[model samples]
Target: MNLGPLEIGLIILAVLLLFGYKKLPDASRSLGRSMRIFKGEMKGMKDDDVRGKEEATTVRGQLAPPAAASPTAGAPDYEAEALAAEARAAEARAAEARARADAARSGVTPADGTR
Candidate 1:
């Protein structure tokens, strides 16, 4: 199904009627920008896929190397990491609470509700 000149004209007319001439330039500019961004993202995805394929081929003969191989990597000690992260988060929450309390006592609103 080919859109001849008449079909194209009708579509253009419909668009003009839907969005007046005054708004056409802004709409067209936005459309063009969106298309360019979409094209760039698609190109990036294609490049990533190609690189992944190349890497897979290169590693086909040998075992893939470990992502991290520190002395502590032997044992999967995720529990320690989780605990450390939790402790940090708890400290942050405590500090925020203290800031809010101080702000309330001083009769001033905290900068971000937690200062």
Candidate 2:
């Protein structure tokens, strides 16, 4: 249903009469305050989630063993190289999982391997 200016004015008049002019300002102010508080809380939660993800990413980066962390001075360290590759694959899987989780949180259904 669409309301023109006349209908809107009538609704406003009814609300003013029901709520009283003096109480309306206080009610509106409280509503604005509540909205601001809600927005602040949502922002804090988003920031915290982002910060947690950053920390997790750092931890994932650090998961490589000491040997796998860098090139060795001795003959080719095959084992360490393998570990490094495994760690990288694991991190990639984790990143995909994180992406899926983020999509889920945002109410977007993640697409499977199929079209």
lDDT for each residue of candidate 2 in 6-60, tens digit (9 for 90 to 100): 9999999999999999999878865765565456556755865675555444443
After best superposition, candidate 1 residue 77: deviation in angstroms? 16
Please state every model's RMSD to the true fold in angstroms: 14.7, 15.0
Root-mean-square deviation of candidate 2: 15.0
Clashes of each: 0, 0
Tens-place lDDT per residue, model 1, 1-115, is 9999999999999999999999998787657655654565567558656755555434545543455745455764444544565566557656755665566457587686422
Among all candidates shown, the one with the greatest TM-score: 2
Model 1, residue pairs in steric clash: none
TM-score of 1: 0.46
